[model samples]
Target chain A: MSLDIFKERGTPLDRQSFTWKDMVGEPYSKLDDDAFTRVRQILMHGVEQESCRFKHFAARFNPELRLPLARIRRVEHHQATMVNWLMPGDQSTLETTIGFEQVAIEVTAHVAAVEPDPYMAQIYRFGLLEDFDHLYRYAALMDRLCGKDANNILQSYTDVMPGRPTSVEHRAPEDDLRLHYQKTRAAPLTKIHAALITGSEWQTRDYYLTVGPTFADPIARQLYAEIASIEEQHVTQYEALSDPSETWLEKWLVQEATEVYAYWSCYSQEQNPRIKLIWERFLSYELEHLRLVRELMQKLENRDPAELLPAEFPDPLSFTSHRKFVRETLAAEVDLRARGYDIVPMDQDSPASIAYRAQLNAGGSPSEAVAAGYHWRPGTELTDRRVRDAAFAPLSGQEAAQ
Target chain B: MNKNDRPTDIGINRTGIALSPLDGPLTAEGASAAPPSSAGSWQDAAMVRLRYAAEASEFGHMPPPATLRGLAKTAKELLKGHKANVLLDKLGERLAFERTGVRLYDGLIVKFEANGSWEGGPTLEELVAFRSDEARHFELMVQALVKLGADPTAMTPSADITAVESLGVLQVISDPRTGLAHALHAQQIAELADVAGWDLLASLSETLGHTELAAECRRALAQENLHAAAVARWLKAHAEVAARGELEQAVAS
Candidate 1:
């Protein structure tokens, strides 16, 4: 398939077909030989043997998008109410200001550990950019209203922002890096949860494209499909480093379903009038996105949409959370590996080392051939028995797929 | 003047005008046990000391102003002694939220999806929450200063003016008519307008640095000042009027 053939044949359907070529780029070549080997192995003995079925869920507006939008709204409205309250008292503007230091620290940290891929980094930057704009806008608004530059005074805290990216590894073991990040008595649970949801979204974007072709809404389908394809690229990039066995499709499904539920559950308790309005609007949007994805999955399976709902995710919130869950998952990686599942990285190490170790352990023997499959220069035998046991055990393709 | 000798027409504006100047740093106990101040008007002695915290914040000891060097210094400062840790630990929660405003401000200004809304802002409610946090700090500081006896009756004299000298730059750009004090005065009027019912002006006296100068007194003084300025302008006009009086009539003839 040369460029001319694609140019001539390129309708939406043609584009859909072109996605695989675009993604893998003329498969069965060295460019994807390693990925192909891993994918095929997982697809055949791993996924195909499993009775994993996707059911149809009807297309509906997405509900999860509301969470972020509503949160933005709530923060805004609260500022106004606070201003009105202050007018009589001659008090300085209070409500319009947000905690800048925390946000800066979070952004700085995120940018630092940020997987170092262009696309992923770009999207993350976009999100951070939006968040940054929100912070400054709030500051300016406060300054204008208060007649004093309270925003500048308030933002003075960022002056204390860590000048350097201090990783957990770089800091002395006795030194608490958490304090360096912030003096927060505790991480605000809401922010922690939001971060987790974001991580899940990051993971899902890649996974969703595997089944993007079958959607009914041209706009929704096309947008998601486009995003999904980009996401697949991201997943591949990540896969080269960690959790090589998990298909992009499985990761998307898990992330999407989990995120939808997480956002819905958290925002469910919103009582503020502004928060309630935005939450409802956002919830509707996410629900629709969820429904569209589920229905597409079901259509692909040739099943009733009602049956597809379960496959789409009857309970999406199961994956709700942020780094705490990631931390938990990391901590339990060894135990999970021992249970014969190809797992996420156990600690903060180069993805190459982690992937090589996991792959070697899965081969069941410390042979140079298996290590070679990991793309490692030969001779690193599996000294860790735990890794060996988890690697060689009878692993399910579905387990690998997820 | 004796209470009765003060004219009743002036209303309660005369009530605390003669009260001695408020004075002092807050008691050590109060400083140590400072309450988590609400996001509003200056209220008590403890809040006044928080002004120093705010001042320190301005110099880059805290968030937005923080640089790597500043943060390292702050960390070092915070680690100076067991007592310093106590101060940092106690204030850290509020401080974290304070920094959140810095980060969130970025979101509110530039990237908000203004789509058909006023200025494409976050709803009023969100803004209020953010503002309230800031207001609490300001109010706490003001109250603390008043509690410590910074004069509410008048801007502190020129020597004391140095305390407010940093704020003098504000005078250059702001209108003198509705300068900081008048702006504060207007804010009080607006707050009390609906609640001329709350007698909140009086309630706020000790807290507002108004123990000797209530809102009514401020408004009265503002009126007197305006009257005096008007009279001076009128006198100048009369001088011209008298001089031109005969000439004007002659011209008309």
Candidate 2:
């Protein structure tokens, strides 16, 4: 169930086609499908988006690449549609957001565990805990505001407890920047991980910005604003990990390789037969994308694609729960703070970040207010005997009169 | 030439004050003062949409029956050369609405707890009972659908559409900013829909010759009618208190 990225001739770029009906086929069952199915969906959509985004930029600057990039970008566009439309309309924005954070937690956890670069792995671990905290905040919102269980989406695969507090995750932009992996020295898996995560966070930030205003709830709106800001910080932090010296063709080649690897991973682990076929079809389509990009790189840049991409992808991403690893990371690294390319202790936290966080919190933290006194219960905190009885009982004065 | 369909035809429509000799010229002058921001066919936007709309698939289809019993029932109905599936479809729709209705009540109850009830508003106990009734009604639908060999949990076409229709009210009720009165106003919307849903289900069941299910739906409809009436009264109380400028005093009292 491994894929050879350098060898597989997936559906040729000319053959990558979709009708609107095929693009928006039946969605997975919200109630019955595995949560990991959704994890795969959100991640693949983000991966395709980043490829499309990068190709467009490359087209702008590199005159020779416009037509090839346009052809590839069109397929990437339809591929993104087919993947994202698997999310049914029935899942609310907040509930789909729950699925988004699950992708963030588990996928980042998988990469962090396997990344060979110690510095890059630390970056993944740090981002992992922040997303884990987001799941907790949103789970509380879902329970308190929506009166629905987030575990219904989470399926108990990921924990619903806090990680590093999101209110404190706000840092100065400079502090958010991290050291780049050397293009010559970084593992193939490291480059793919950076692109995958940066793209996923970018889409998340954009999704929140787009949908945040549609909410009439003031706190939910503020919560989306606050969280989307952190996602922006994440985009800054993770995108900086890729070496700046890599040429546009070099970057494009790696982007296609990342898509190929991600779809391959999804195809291997997909449980739903229908969605699995989508993953299968898209996997071949990406392989062809990788083949075309690799050929273009060789022709235009005179660099062998074999020299850049691995003959075989590193192990497919682990789609299983990382609850133990996540909890252990929270226990160990939750206190780690950023200080200009370095994760450090609170005593070593950058002064600029402290001042920045202070100004932001002066207005009151929506993350804190939304989760104040919030404890995750099986159903909700309202199900707790003390809270339930008190909540359902008479008002204080009314009780006194009674 | 067809005036309406002609893109640039200067039709004589008096929607504006162009007919008024006094202010019409002034208003028309103000309208023409600001140039359009950019010039392109608005058709550019509409054409892309038109193509997609022409090419789009449906929202979804009814899932095939999960069990042989269900498949046989569906097949028998189809063979009967009748619309037996229609009854089960509407039943599933009712089932989904009642299930979400239970959660909607739960969200409203949380709103009540944080922002306490006003004078002549719902008691904590009454809201709890409302939630209970929703739960029971949804379960009743589940039983009824199963007895008819339908999947109670499937999002029927009508079920999916009902969720879309009710999404706005759910958002309002779930908002932490909304007060008890605001939540009751939203609850009244749900109650209104619930009463109609039950009424239709009862009549549909009777027409389909399910007398027992019809009677049960009638009972649920009665509960929904009471809910609608009570919710309307509570909203009026809150509205009147605001009108009297005694909302703070009434709530405190």
TM-score to true structure, per model: 0.22, 0.64
iRMSD for each candidate structure, in the order shown? 31.9, 28.3
Docking class of 2: incorrect
Cα lDDT of model 2 by residue, A209-307, tens digit = 988887755667778999999999999999999999999988987898888888889988998899999988988988887888878888888888788
Q: Which stretches of candidate 1 lie over 4 Å from their true place?
A: A1-252, A301-402, B1-253
TM-score of chain B of 2: 0.77
Q: Write the per-residue lDDT of candidate 2 for residues B106-197, one digit (tens) a residue.
A: 99888777766667778889889988999999999998777666678788989998998898788778755457777777788889999999
Residues B1-253, model 1: lDDT tens digits? 1111111113322112121122111111221232211221111212222333445532213222112243345344433434432222223322232233233323332222221112111244543454454444334434433333232223222212222332322222132222222222222222222133113333443343334435543443343343234323433443343354432332222
Error of 1 at B84 (Å): 48
Each candidate: RMSD to true structure?
28.8, 24.7
Against the reference, the lDDT scores of all candidates come to 0.28, 0.80
lDDT of 1 at B239: 38
Give me the candidate number with maximum lDDT.
Answer: 2
User: What is the C-alpha lDDT profile of model 1 across A1-402, one tens digit per residue?
Assistant: 011111121112111121222222211211112221211111111111111111111112234333432332232233223222212112222321233222322332243233333333323332332232223333322322233332222222221111111110111111111111121221222222223423433334423453344332222233334334333332233222222242332333333333343334324543333433433443343344344444444554454433212322222222111223222222333121110112223243444443544553352221111111111001111222432343332223323443
